[model samples]
Target: MSVQGTPDELVEILRETVVSLVRRDGPDLSARQLGVFLTVYLGEGPHTVRGLAEALNIGKPAITRALDRLEEFKLARRKINPADRRSVHVQRTTRGAALLREISVTMAEAANPQRTAGTPTGSQQGLKP
Candidate 1:
């Protein structure tokens, strides 16, 4: 089903998602790390460090650091491109996919009141029209 909501409704959904994420056990990811991770996971794969840096408009070193963190968390990994030994391809990990799925579930729960437990409806969620 297509997800449709106003800006305010989306904001409330995001707020609930964040709260749910906070309650879940995991290390807090920095904005940059999260950005890099999402870009790698959500976009076209077999991504290279240079391509990622370019896509993010960020420095290669910065992307490397983000990749390092993601690797530490078992989220993403890089491997040498067999075609071009000099370059590496960023690969998605099962752990990363699981985390992404969890986030998606959280977002879905927040959006669907029937699925959410004890969640307020409409303006009760403290969102202004």
Candidate 2:
């Protein structure tokens, strides 16, 4: 698929996004954890351990470990499926949904071309003209 925007612009967007997130004192999510969290929050569900594992190309144990951390942080939870005793479903917590909203807002602000001087730019605190 074709990607839009120059490498530098993309770099700037990501840089600012991270800075904005950090400024908010957000939780530190590992790459893998972020992937699973985003997938679960953004995708349609009744998500399961097995389904998340396969979708993320990760093993079930890894998903379990991530889920464990998510649970520890009160970001996500697992419930025993009522219809299938052998199955577990992952559900998003109120905090998790709130975090997703925070991330979405941060990303939008960082990417806004009209963002002011104080906004982070890859190497500096100002966006290039």
Q: Which candidate tops TM-score?
A: 2
Question: How big is the positional error of residue 120 in model 2, measured in Å on the Cα after superposition?
Answer: 5.9
Q: Identify the leading candidate in terms of lDDT.
A: 1
Writing each residue's lDDT as its tens digit, candidate 1 over 86-120 gives 99999999999998998888898788857765766
Candidate 2 structure quality by residue, lDDT tens digits, 29-109: 777888899999998899999999999999999999999988888889999999998999999999999999988887777
Q: After superposing candidate 1, which stretches have Cα over 4 Å from the reference?
A: 1-3, 115-129
Per-candidate total of colliding backbone pairs:
0, 0
User: Which runs of model 2 end up more than 4 angstroms from their true locations?
Assistant: 1-4, 116-120, 125-129
